[model samples]
Target: MTSSADAPRSGPVSAWAPLAIPAFRVLWFAQLGSNIGTWMQTVGAQWYLVDA
Candidate 1:
């Protein structure tokens, strides 16, 4: 099998870009912002867990 060094770089690293079309940009941004907010909440929970 080929090693990680042989991985293709020509394509996108994520499939998220297709949702960036003008009609979808607003909804996409809203969803992404909410996701980031949820991420922050999870991080806070982890921090508290580690501290305790």
Candidate 2:
């Protein structure tokens, strides 16, 4: 039989834990904005090509 001390400690992990860091939060937002801009540019190019 396993005692309480021998049992594995399972804890709930927060998804937003990493965003708690100021540097990480800044980089995350910057990356998100870059991805959105790239997506918009791609869509615009496709629409222009299709219409031309």
State in Å the error of residue 39, model 1.
0.7
Error of 1 at 27 (Å): 0.5
Clashes of each: 0, 0
Candidate 2, residues 1-52, lDDT tens digits: the string is 9999798768986899899899999999999999999999999999999999
Off by over 4 Å in 1: 1-22
Best by TM-score: 2
Off by over 4 Å in 2: 1-10
Report the CA-based lDDT of candidate 1 relative to the real structure. Answer: 0.86
Clashing pairs in 2: none
Task: Give the TM-score of each candidate.
Answer: 0.54, 0.78
Candidate-wise lDDT, in order: 0.86, 0.95
